[model samples]
Target: MTQKVLVTSIFLHAGGEVDHLLRAEGFEPTYAPALTKRTEDELIGLLDGVSGAIIANEPFTDRVLAAAPDLKVISRTGVGFDSIDVAAATQRGVVVCNTPNVNRYAVAEWTLAMMLGCARHAVKNWTEMNAGGFKRFEGTELYGKTLGLAGLGGIGKEVARRAHAFGMTLLAVEEYQDQAFAAQYGVTYVDLETALEQSDFLSLHLPLNAQTRHLINAERLARMKPSACLINTARGGVVDTVALAQALREGTIAAAALDVFEEEPLPADSHLHALENLLMSPHVGGVTTEARQMSGVRAAENLILALKGQAPASPVNPEVIPTARYAVSAT
Candidate 1:
């Protein structure tokens, strides 16, 4: 029987390179691009005989997994696994993998861009200038500012490295500490409260989990300096959208720039759209051309490896691989 691999990410292999790579690996590839919104039923239908998949933000719930008994591996094109039911995947002995390191620099750079955009009123000033106005929009400089990082993972570390070059002091709230790295980067590992209070620009780089979801609420917003700006290039659920809207409305914080939101394609009637202090992007922080190509290749490689009964380089559920139905034998 020929092994089948489904490609669900809209942009994956759009350039033909990853498709060629998949074909070169002697696997039959099914292309079902979810250009707009993909329903759960659509995903279940696509998983008919698929042994592996390269997916985007599509939800692979327990029901969906139960429907696809042939699904042995799911290789995500990005770092987030929140859309997928990881616990269910583990229980079902389905290997879950993600493309990490590849997009960190891109996301980190986008975070910096958003931070600077908020600090310098880039969009507001440009709008005013284009609308026949001048000398009305003043901007703040990043020099000698305090930047707080909520998480210091790959992307957070890259953000710190760039921010350091701008002569900004760094403060972080990370579970694990690397003293040597902190010393080299001049970063002070502080409690979340202190990081919030002292930061001129607070950036979030946390993953979306139960503990991290809505971690930044109204109270946390109130703790931040009234003149400070918030930047989130991380998962949308990390901050409370309702509270952020209110905070921006009441000047609890001076401004915010977000690439991700709780509800993607941010609803047309959302209050966030009405807040001028909030800048929004449609979660394209990791969608650069280079990132897309790298992510696609990495995800394809992971899927191929998992299906070939080999261990994937970046498995989110490594514990499941040992007893997986497709586990490679140790020779």
Candidate 2:
């Protein structure tokens, strides 16, 4: 029987190059009908006979993985894997791979857009004017403004490079600092607390993990300057969603722009929905036509390699490969 791979990454074309690539190898491809994320139950239903999965940030919990006996590999677009239960996948001998650096520039560009939008009150002004209310608002220039990055990784470095061109001051918080890059870009290394207090635009580029989850909460939000803006193109759980809603509602910060959310689709009754001070997007920060294609191809290659009983490009849990369903030694 031809092995089946489920494509839940909307970024990957349902019938594009990767689809053709899979077909050429005699592998069958199936796509999720909608662009929305799939629940665990939905994923279990989708993975009935699937041997591999090309996914976005779908909830692939232990229960879902346990239900799919045939699944051998999972290739996710973009770098985040917080939604997947890696320990469970590893225990089940499933290879998990991620496409990284593919969306770095896309995310960096989106960060700048969000920063500028918040700085200039562009979203609020546009919303007001569209509703027939006329008001000219004073906007701040990025030049000479302090930009504190929560994490100085690939995306953060790109953001530093771009912000430097605008003559903005750069500060960053990272566990492992790149000394040469910091000196080249003139980035000041600081702790998260310092970044929060000093930044005119506090942008997040960190991952969501144990130490970093809810890294920004009520107390931290209070530390920000009243004229400051917060930009999050990274994970949403970094900032306390409830605290953020209260802050935005009370003008705790000048404005904020978020491309990701604690909850996907940000329910209709969410407190964030009515805030004119908040600008929200459907988690499309690391997304552009170019980036999407790069990520899609990388995800496809990882899936294809793992399915062929070979080592993938970037496996998160390489230890599983030896005993993984396909049973191959790591290259």
Candidate 3:
């Protein structure tokens, strides 16, 4: 019996490369593009009899996992796996993997772009110019400004490199500090509070977890300088949306540019839409052409290896490998 694999991410099959890879591995491929709004019922229905899947930002709750007993592996096309319940997957002996390094530059570049855009009032200036009006908005220069990083992972490191090139001072807060890296990059290791209070621009690169969810709350936002700008390309739930909207509205912070939001599609009736100091993108921070292609290839490889009972390149839940019932035989 040929094992089946579901390809749920729209970008994974972009050039049909992932499908080709699945075929080469003797796995039947099913295409059910979720387009970033996958419901639990939809995922359950699509996952029936699927041994593996390439998912995007779909939520895989414990209930959803219970419905798909045949699912042995889940390979995410991007680094962020917050949408998937890893603990539930691990308990079920399902291997979870993600493509991480592929999108570091893409997300880092988007972060810097948003930072510069917010600093220079790029969107507002262009909008006013197009509306048959002349409004000269004086903008701040990025050079000589302090950039605070919430995490110093791959994406954060890339951002630091670019920020340094632009002559920006760096401050960072990371759970695992690399003293050598900080010294080489001239990044000052500081506490979260100090980073927020002293930064002219704060960029979030942390993951969304129990401890990190709503990490940037009202109290932390209050600690930031009124002239500071916040940039988030990491995860939406990392920052409290209500607190951020309130901050932007009351000038608690000067501005914010977000590539991710707590509620995706950012509800049409959301208060964030009315704020002029806020810049929003439809979460395309890591959607560059090169990044997408690389991630697609990596995700496919992960699924194929896991289904074959071989170890995946980057398993998010490696603890399950030892006890996984479907693990590939070591030949």
Best candidate, lDDT? 3
Over the stretch 148-246, how does candidate 2's per-residue lDDT look in tens digits?
Answer: 998899999999999999999999999999999999999999998899899999999888888879988999999998888898988989889889888
Q: Which stretches of candidate 1 lie over 4 Å from their true place?
A: 327-331
Provide the TM-score for each candidate, comma-separated. 0.96, 0.94, 0.97
Q: 158-197 in candidate 3: lDDT tens per residue?
A: 9999999999999999989999989899999999999999
Write the residue-wise lDDT of candidate 1 on 268-328 in tens digits. 8888888889899999999889999899999998888887778899999999877788853
- Candidate 1 vs 3: which has more lDDT: 3
Number of backbone-clashing residue pairs for each candidate, in the order shown: 0, 0, 1
Worst 10 residues of 1 by lDDT: 322-331
Residue pairs with clashing backbones, model 1: none
Query: lDDT of all predictions, in order shown?
Result: 0.90, 0.88, 0.91
Ranked candidates (lDDT, high to low) = 3, 1, 2
Q: Tell me each candidate's RMSD, in Å, in order.
A: 2.1, 2.4, 1.8
